[model samples]
Target: MKLTVHTFASLDGVMQGPGSPEEDPSGGFDRGGWVVPFMEEDFGRVVDSWFARTTELLFGRTTYDLMAGYWPQVTDPDDAVAAVLNGSPKHLVSMTVTAPSWANTVSVIADDVAGRVRELTNRPGGELQVHGSWRLVQALHEAGLVDEYRIIEFPVVVGEGKRIFRDGATASSFDVVETQVLGSGAVYRVLRPTPFTRGAFSVEDGRETVALDV
Candidate 1:
């Protein structure tokens, strides 16, 4: 299975409190819901495509709590995204949450998160997608367990909030597989993480040249 980190972020990479003021206020983020103004059909379409391929979900404790507190209230039967989220198997990474209240929710509190994730991904051909799990994604990134990234960047910037990519994130590289721009001016990208390969740039014959194999 492919482990994918899917999230909606701002131009500055802020992912918290995108839905509403009450959605997330942990960091005293008064500028909540910064990405709401840019919501449009194109954005929905892109999100729909992203969720369509998800077979399972991985989330952080906070994200799970937030989603559990809201998603069950969305009674729209025609809502594909809501249905997927509510129905798919959810794995929450938390030591505090001993029992998950959500119907299909489970917890991964073991110290061997990488091993457990490997056991999960090695099961079959499916996508174990992580959505809005900023904290958990950090650990997964550090462990080099994340495979793909589907990020939708909004034009607005929340000066203070939890960002998708934090300062201490593991240094790595990825190959951008696809990109699109919605009518709301949101830019979406699909990337595959690859090994970090680096080289130096040199001045050759009065021109700068990249020494990729150096």
Candidate 2:
């Protein structure tokens, strides 16, 4: 199983709440529904494609509870996201949540976070997808556990909110696997993490010089 992170973000990288106004008000985020205006068929198509590859899900405590509270009630038979979300097993990372009430869910404490995730990653599967788990994603990222990222970048800028890439995130490089622009101007991007490499260009002694390092 490969660990993949899927998320929706604003142009400025805010990932607090994209669904509803009250979904997350942590930092008094008023632009919670910034991604709503840009939601269209093209965006749905990208999401559907992503869902097709999901085998399981890992989430932060907040994201887990929020999703568990909402997704179960979404009974639309044709809703691809709701379908996959309801069926896939979920692991919630937290120091608190001991007994998860959600079906097919388990609590992963901070001490066991990496160990549990690694166990899942070593399993044979398509993708252990992590969606909207900002804080958990931060820990996984800093631990060098995330293999790829699937993101929907909205056109609006929220200015202030919890970002997917937080301040203490690990320094790593990513290679764009694919990119597609939606009809509503939102862009869907697939990125694979890679070892950081660099190149420097310099003009010395009237000639251009270059140095590359990996």
Candidate 3:
């Protein structure tokens, strides 16, 4: 299984709550629902594309709770996102959530979460996707487990909120697999992690010399 992460963020990288104002208010974050104004057909199409590859869903407690409370109620058979989310197998990572009420919950991983997720990846499947789980995404990133990132960067500068790439994150680089700018000024980016690189530029013989360690 390929571990993939899907998320929505502001230009400033805030990914706290893109859905509603009351979605995630942790840390006094009042700048929720920033992605709403920019939502358009393009955004839906991009997100649907992500869901198309999802064979399983991996989520942190908060995101899982939010999704479970909402998506199951969306009993629209024609809705592709709701269908995929409600039907796919799910893995929740949390010590507090002992009994998940969501349908098709495979396991609740508390200890050795990275190890468990690695085990899941070793299994044969299409894509085990993590959506709106910033904290879990960070842990998986640190463990070098995320295979791809599908991000929709909205054109808004949320002054204060939880960011996707928090401070003191592991230094890394990504290979841009694809990029598309919507008419709403939102940018959809597909990125794959690459080895972190370092480089330096200097002037030699009046010409520029570049040195890089890949």
Q: Rate the local accuracy (lDDT) of all candidates.
A: 0.86, 0.87, 0.91
Residues 93-195 of candidate 3 have per-residue lDDT tens digits of 9999899999999999999999999999999999999998888999999999999999989888988887777799898999999999987999899999998
Worst 10 residues of 3 by lDDT: 157-166
Least well predicted 10-residue stretch by lDDT in candidate 2 = 104-113
Off by over 4 Å in 2: 207-209
Q: What is candidate 2's lDDT per residue for 1-214, written digit by digit as tens?
A: 9999999999889889899899998877776777788889998889889889989888888898899899999999989889899988877787878888788875465677888899989989899999998988888888889999999998887899999898857778899999999999988999999987888999999999999982
| Candidates ranked, most accurate by lDDT first | 3, 2, 1
What candidate 3 gets wrong by more than 4 Å, as runs, is: none
Predicted structure with the largest TM-score when compared to the true one: 3
Cα TM-score of candidate 2: 0.93
Task: Pick the lDDT winner.
Answer: 3
Report the Cα lDDT for candidate 2.
Answer: 0.87
* Each prediction's number of clashing residue pairs: 0, 0, 0
Clashing pairs in 1: none
Worst 10 residues of 1 by lDDT: 105-114
In the predicted model 3, the residue pairs found to clash are: none
